[model samples]
Target: MSRLKNLKKLLTVLRVALSLVAACTFSTVSSAALEESISQPPDDYVLVRRVIDARYFTPESVVSRPDAAGTQGSEETWPDIKLRPSLNLKEALQSNIAREITISEQDALSKVVLREYGFGQKNSLQAYAAIEEKIVELNDLGAPENLKAGAVIKIPALPRMALSEPNLLNKYNKIPKGSMYPSLSKVTSFDAFNPVTQAFTEKPVVSGDGRDGSPLVIEHLWLPKDYKDHLGGIELDQSYEEVQAQVISVNMESESLAEDYQSIPFLSAEERMIIKSKLSGQPKLKPVLIVLDDGWPNDEAFYDSRKFVSEALEMIKKRFNYPVALQHPSSQSRVFTDYPKEAFHARSIHKSLATLVELEPSRVWDDQRVRVVYIPLSTAQVYSKAMLEELVVLRLIDDFMLGARGDPVPDKEVKAKRKIARDIVKRLKQDIGVKDLSTDKAIIESALVFADLYAVASGNPYVVNFSWTTRKREHKFTHFDFNQGILVSAAGNSSLNNCKSCRPNLAYSKECECADNAAAEERWFAVRSVSNQDVVAVMNTARDGSLQCRSSIVGSRSVDPLAISFNGYVSDSICGTSFAAPRVAWLFAAKLAYIPPQEFSIYDAPDKGHKLREIVKKSRQGGASGDQYGLDIKKLFEN
Candidate 1:
């Protein structure tokens, strides 16, 4: 009887062990399946994929839109390797200094030069003279019109006594009796790309008659499609047929924006009152436009560029009566190795906030509050559809899913980090008065964008998948709703010489398709400009006058009198449509002062400021194209 009982116990134990093993195997298999599911493409993207399919993907074959309402037949091509123009402002100042010192945002070039190269405070005049000499040296190299931070400039080697023959550029400063302002110039030195010149072209003798138009107006320009034809008045020989391309670049016209606006309820009575109070008087009309760029110059370039940008702002304010600010945040910060490039971009944005507060004291309404947005450049170098969608998902999860419910995530450490990030984002959002980031709305007036997004995109092959297309549409929608104040964009710099696909288009053949889809999107509304063309062309849509550039994506949409300068103070030498966007932004800011209360009310509407289409309605002027009227600001603003 004892042996039988023992056998029963052994059988039970064996059965229990077997059950445990089976359960363990089931759990392992289930976990593996879950991971596999996560690894696969999300359902939305399952039907579509990136052409390059990598972290850094570049689109191949950029052709102009065949059906585009702008100039057709000329296909713009972008190359795998970019060949941009280069100018060295730091080197220009090198001969005058004993050694160069890196500059900071807060440092004044005059004071710094005085401290490093001056004899003493008693010899202030002499120090000022030395600084003047350095300024002239910079101008010769086609430096940015303003003083830039984050570059290295020279400490003049000349003794204070030697520079005492009166500062050559001192007369340019227009500060009040007690304020000391840096020398600034409206004249740009950097040779801008000229579709007419077939090469980088300089301004043909600035008009002494002075611009009669509103300083705030933005002119969109495109690169010349046929360089030889424009410059030599002779058609150039071509090797291949033109490639028909379609670029759905973001197009934010007034009509689509108006429709978008109606969907959102107009501001409440209280909100309207608040807006009225803030923007009531002309004094409140101070429009703060910001020019943002990517890429940092060498240490030497940083010094010169910082000072140049600073001085340029002052100059524009005094001469054009335009209050424009600039912020070029680079991936390379002071401690270049410490953080990722994205961090630096965030820093640049923060810097723009600081700058706004400094430029206009009233901007501190709620502890240095300022509205901000993002406007893509012509090249689409600042973003990709995949990356942009990733950002949206991250924002939704962090701001709503995880934190909105006021519940802590299961992981304590992750929750803590997210909390910190959330705080920062919340602070900025409030400052900009952004009620919700979930949809595209214009709650902010300022914007931030990178020019390199297009430059980088040029290297990848085009993807026509649903995911890519949808993301792009979403991105444009976001920008459209991001700012109620205004939208400013750059017409890309892809021209015959720089873009690989452009050469074949000289013959007007159909062999390459390198159009930028971003340029075609309809959410683009505010202002856009190119560098070389004359008479800014308005697009086919009644509200499409906003589209500008010579990429052939916009058939016959050529504009004239567009101007740009090299950011010589920042780097060895580089120029692009990216730089032109900021210049246009500055111009637009100048016109803000003239905006009437009635016109400003557009922001309070659902469409925000979409009804304010001031690009094509404005009068035109002739200069390089001869005997034509110039862009008349008085008529555009007054009308």
Candidate 2:
């Protein structure tokens, strides 16, 4: 019996050794096959080096999928495997936990392991081998053959230094260089400004205007030409201004008749000529206006709605002799279907641009050098519920910190608190079945819009017209400091009572008169709510300068320094505060144009908005006194 047992043990050992050799051979063959498959990577895919070094995993860190079949003669089956916490490899290794995932048809073992471990794709052989061994050991996968479609596997918990590390394969999935869409993976900087002459050598000279004889070269870092070609093109026509005005009037009046609204009337040739005659001898100064709103219609019609944006901009250029560059969404946008109100969006944009350049051309500065840039608000509100919830919670956290700890919380504490908030939001989202709102495409598009806005603002003196608003009161993340320019935001149309003075404690005390006991009235509006000095809010007013009943009062002098503007028929059928905001934007642009380029340094001052407000106030007829300062276009230019 001893001799038989010894022989059987030797036979069992030999069988096991032979199986191990066969497995090694199979793994070698499978690796070669994987190499062959990845040799010709897809067009959208790119190879990336490993970001972090591989670390050792303890035995307890390895976990296996439960057997699908029950033990022999047993009636019980194992429960489905629960997913490990969404921690990176390093974190998982520290916690001694392994994540279980099922393999899909398109997944390669190497890519799967790389992505799962936060190592990114196209990792080096040495880096891949280290992680591969642990993954295979954890799931008892001897060969790549075990990684079949729908096969269950365990991912060894790995740690990544940064949580914001992006998967390279996912990052560059479809965005190629010079594509219509802008790249969001990297921070884009627009440092180079486009010269008015377009030629690098020929600098346009703006003489006179009480300068020191040196030529005043006005240059702006406008949107890139490639970006323009993709989103909207730059329209620069040198046709006689009067002739262009006549063409604009004829086109606008004819097209408006077909739309749902009454006929759109533009500045008549006679009216335009009279304005030109008033500024006949003034030196032409190039003033740029950036309009932020919904996208305009491309040549192709998504629907039968009126297509007046391109025509309106062209007419504005003709009437004012200014070049208009639009940064709206292209028809090729993936989220094109999301924007159902393009017609209304286009009208609002048109109303703003027209209010600034055509309808109320500054009498002091020649309209010849005006430049209008239209930037789209966004392709669509593709923000996920998770992101919105996170923002809401984060805002509350910030407010609490400000009230308790006071302003400027420490960076370390802020990061720690924010991380906890984000984790809470993530867990809640999973429990509530709220899908993440952001996609690769949406992120790229949104990033492009903001990047363009930053680029434009960084350049020459510019006025950004935000004729839109969001219900979210606090925009801690979205708030931008236009140090070189000013932001004119529409005080939303929600008709909520102003609660600018209401404190946090007041809301709980029930003494606040706001519609919802809000801590701040600006809470209902985004940009308007921001307490930045550069931002000026505007509300709607009748033709005679009486505040419109429907418009929301910002209730703060700092917010609504120049409060009102006429928002009527040619604006929107609804006549929103959207039209009112642009008139103020025009006022700023006109003031910028009035100042000599040598004195452009005034915009760099912190009190530039205040100085401009004072300058505008002095120009007001009767020097309008009260918080509700009505914007008078004629008086604005008289000073």
Best by TM-score: 2
Q: What residue runs in model 2 are displaced by over 4 Å at the alpha carbon? A: 1-285, 297-342, 351-368, 378-459, 473-475, 496-519, 523-530, 557-574, 602-627
**Candidates' lDDT values, in order?**
0.27, 0.37
TM-score between model 1 and native: 0.27
Model 2 Cα RMSD, 1 decimal:
26.5
Q: Model 1, residue 196: displacement in angstroms?
A: 56
Candidate 2 C-alpha lDDT tens digits along 1-639: 999999999999999999999999999999988754543212121111011112222221232213212221111111121211121233223221233566889887876865554443343444455567656766678975577888766664333212222233332211111100111111022111212312111111211122111111111111222322322211211110000000000000101112464434433465345444443445335456656444333322221111223333334334323233222334455333233434445454454445335434353222444455543323232222223233323332332232122233334334433433332222211111011111111122222233223323333455666565533311122323334565666765554435433322222333334423111444322334335434566655554443443454455433333333344235335355666666567656755656665564545545554565455445443433332255554555555
Off by over 4 Å in 1: 1-282, 290-483, 498-553, 556-572, 602-608, 619-639
TM-scores for every predicted model = 0.27, 0.39
Clashes of 2: 9
Error of 1 at 637 (Å): 6.5
